[model samples]
Target: MPPGITTLAADAPTLSAANTGFMLICSALVMLMTPALAFFYGGMVRVKSTLNMLMMSFISLGIVTILWVLYGFSLTFGTDAGSVIGWSQDFLGLSGIGVNELWDGTTIPVYVFAVFQLMFAVLTPALISGALADRVKFTSWALFITLWVTVVYFPVAHWVWGSGGWLAELGVIDFAGGTAVHINAGAAALGVIVVIGKRVGFKKDPMRPHSLPLVMLGAALLWFGWFGFNAGSWLGNDDGVGAVMFVNTQVATAAAMLAWLGYEKLRHGSFTTLGAASGAVAGLVAITPAGGAVSPLGAIAVGAVAGVVCAMAVGLKYKLGYDDSLDVVGVHLVGGVIGSLLVGFFATGGVQSDAKGLFYGGGLDQLGKQAVGVFAVLAYSLVVSAVLALLVDRTLGMRVDEDDEISGIDQVEHAETAYDFSGAGGGAAPRATASAPGTPAAPTNKKVDA
Candidate 1:
């Protein structure tokens, strides 16, 4: 071969088919999480608002996908803009990227990276929906998602994960999305619920979950998908970092589940299914940021701490009376903080980067950096999300009418009910009699089982 041809071949980037396949699968797994969240949040709401709850999460998959393709990806992953946001004309509409272009230093195609990140963008806003369940108008909710992702999620994601992002430069150790996804969504949930006010009855109502089975299923799916969410964030498993992350994710989640059940058994005297499901999710959230940085043992600590902290935090809504309908603030916000901060203590100085946590002899320096990343995302998301919620509320009317809310958001918003009780209900069918059928079937006063 000619010298020029040989040099060209040497300089050209090599694509890893294995890594590409892995990331693509990971992207699909992350995408599955949005619908999984739909199920999780759906099962937590009253029967009257079940479909509405599901739709709130499912809508994000549609809205965020379009935005990400257009400019969301650019605003997030493009060239650095003053350490706050990203901007690159080549990334606008994702039009200028070549088919084989890799993401900075990664082996997978940039498109794969874009789609993978897009899934994260999709799921974050869906998380906030749990807090707003059973109250907001569907159209208003959809609009809020559009505005929230644009104003809040994109910028925060950039700050944490984008190239030259402030937190990334400050040495924050978010391997996945503890700060960007969970805390951001959790804080945003608090902001919106504070603005939107409580569900109709507030603390007076029972508000028990309509279906524990659905919640369990959703939690199970989240646990499965999180392997991709946490492990795949390493981009590839070639160096064993991703494999270690995968292992840490599992260890932490198991520890968290057991810890949460233990807390419930001690505090409430029973290991309820809801508690089990919630505990598992708390574990998943706690390990998301810490998994890549900590050992399996450290992950256990992170998971256990989050499980107990979140279990207790869920009750704060009652004490403070803000009405976070589904405990997004408790699990995501608290768990995210637990994972992010613990990295300052549990980090092994062997994975992701050389940064060591306090326990590893790195001292308070890394802890301080983690603190900045945590509070920065928290404060920004809280203030801005509240403002946006207020904007949407004033103009478009965030809540449904009082009567509509009392009746059911599913019927009012979606024009359908989650369960078709019509055929089996009180007035659905005439009572059948064992006596003479022709005798009007009237004398029998037995109630129908509808």
Candidate 2:
């Protein structure tokens, strides 16, 4: 127990129990986001499409877990080749790594790192399901995601985070995944929407969510899980940068929620639960990239701007004549761009990287880098996703038939219903409940007494 000897030993890096435990908890929290996403999108669709919507997000957990274990992780993080993609398949199916294998400089095992990233792989494609709500074929969507992650997401993940990645080489910063996850998925969603066409009823039909409470619940779950999503990207328990990320995640999200409410009240003369949930999500997406770099006040500005811009952007689908079913293009695409760009202006040298944004006297250096990353992912995703969607549509059929669509995708696609408006008995079952004003009545065999 010599003092100098102990000091020397302490200086040497060793296994960290605190960091390991932190990553594990963060991994689990991120895992919850998928199911939470299911609920979020599920509640926003028609009652007839509830199960189908849930299944879309739920299916990703199953599909991506197996895929990531098989080779998804390898292609994304393996030995980098030419800085565009990872080349080694040594870790496929969790094979090459050993029991004592640690992730580079960290005490966390490679397996822990693998599974933590797997949650991200699962969630990215699921984000697109919201845009295609109430229309796409379940089987087609299943296949499309499988192809998409392999072709689009994996490579893009490398470009942003992998060793020797071009973007990494250029000093581009994406602490979480504004480019890889939100912008990528958002662009891909718009691509698929273009190929698949609109929901059966576009401008004419009054389509609304079946359950606002459920939407609120899902948003709450997303906000809860987002702590892991944003903060866990740091992958350690350092109180300095990690703590700042945690605070910024919360601050930005709260500001965005309030900003959205204010915008709603001013424009529509009413604040809505849907606006609150959507704004919170917009905040979450915007902060995902900038949280690690910006101050708390900076985060507030990012979130508030995103909240207002996205709220207004959602209406673009209507004006532009594109059928974006759930405002994915609006919220995710616009919000992601806002966050990514703001990082160029708001980034501080002390937080994580030495890169300072324009406002911090770094000039437009980081801003230009951010723009390149943003549009690069957006363009690549948009083109590739469109091609993939068209291929799926041509070969296997992307949308359900008109008859099945009108009959409710739940019963038509899954042979199950979310809510049985037409109970069991044919003659006396409760159905339609007076049509709920603008909504069409639920079809039932029972005759109503006029």
Candidate 3:
């Protein structure tokens, strides 16, 4: 996130116990986000698909951790290879680095940095699960994560954060992961959904969320954990840049939530719980890349804009005839682009770097640079992820059979359902019914709320 310290003190870099401890706590906070996301996404799908939705997010923790230890860290943070990737023999298997050896230019150990970054790697793939919920095969989704991270995530992480990375060298300002994580995952979600096709009876079914409380709980946890996610990206608090990021994160999220609720009230005539949770997330994504560089007031503008924009963008799937199950492309992809590009207008040139935004008299140069970073990651992740999804679909089969999907993906894929009603009736388990009241008995060409 912070990449590396840009300016060193007079003394040579040495280990700081304070920084190491702080980073360890931050890593744990970030690790909690994947499961929190599981709950958030899990509650948004039909009851029959709840467990499948949760598993899609949870599995990334297991898959990415093993991969990160083996080669993820090396390729992401190792020595630059042609400004496209990284390589380091010592970082292989994480076997060669000493406990006391610090990440270059920082006080924390290389292990600390690696683990911190690993949490990001794990969460990015999990973010895509929301888009493909209720229809994908469990094993096939696992296979996709395995191949996608190896082919797409790892190299992109290097390009954005690694030493001598082309984007970093070009002076693009991404304090966190607006490009590498959110846009990368959002674009991938678009690609996969394009190949996998829509869920059965997508627009015809009401498909209301089965558990709003779970979604709220998940959103609360994500908000708490995101403090660590944003502030800790600065690596340390010695110079107080992390503190500024912390404050900006809170300000922007609050603004986004309020803005989203307002928009929902105006457009839909009701402020739904889903809108609040989504707005909070939109704010979080919008401020991630710009927090360190923008003022607190600037964060509010960014969050408010992203909240209204993403709230409106979520309806595009319906208008365009693409079924993004949980609005991944709308929220993450659009929010990430807002945050990354706004840096060109809001960057103060006093906190993270000397480059000023257009609003600050730096002209259109930085904005142009930001656009290159955003679109490059978008195009690459979109094209590559589509190819990978197609490969998986053609071989292992990405979507379940139409009948299985109609019945329930959870029971078909995992033999478990989110809710069991056998004890209530002393009979076989009850099939999942539409949770929302007054849902139609049969599919119809009725308009459904997004």
What C-alpha lDDT values do all the predictions have?
0.92, 0.91, 0.94
Give per-residue CA lDDT, model 1, range 1-450, as digits (tens).
Answer: 346655455666578999999999999999999999999989999999999999999889999999998999999998999998999899888999999998877789999999999999999999999999889999998999999999899989999999999999888889999999999999999999889999889999899999999999999999999989988999987899999999999999898999999999999999999999999999999999999889999999999999999999999999988999999999999999999999999999998889899999999998999999999999999999999999999999999999999999899998999999667756655556576755664564667696
| Tens-digit per-residue lDDT, 1-450, candidate 3 | 367856555676889999999999999999999999999999899899999999999999999999999999989999999999998999989999998989987999999999999999999999999999889999999999999999999999898999989998998888889999999999999999999999888889899999999999999999998998999999998999999999999999999999999999999999999999999999999999999999999999999999999999999999999889999999999999999999999999888788899999999999999999999999999999999999999999999999999899999989998888777866555455675677666555657799
TM-score of each: 0.93, 0.91, 0.92
lDDT of 2 by residue, 1-450 (tens): 346655464665566788888888999999999999999999999888999999999999999888888889988999998888886667887888887677875667787888888999999999999999888899999999999999999999999998888888887889889999999999999999889898888998878999999999999999999999888888787557888999999999999999999999999999999999999999999999999999999999999999999999999999998999889999999999999999999998879888999999999999999999999999999999999999999999999998888788999889998887675775843543555678876766657699
For model 1, the run of ten residues with the poorest summed lDDT: 1-10
- Residue 177, model 3: lDDT of 91
What ranking emerges by TM-score with the best candidate at the front? 1, 3, 2
Error of 3 at 192 (Å): 0.6
- lDDT for position 258 in model 2: 98
Q: Give the CA lDDT, 0 to 100, for residue 310 in model 1.
A: 93
lDDT of 1 at 50: 94
Best by lDDT: 3
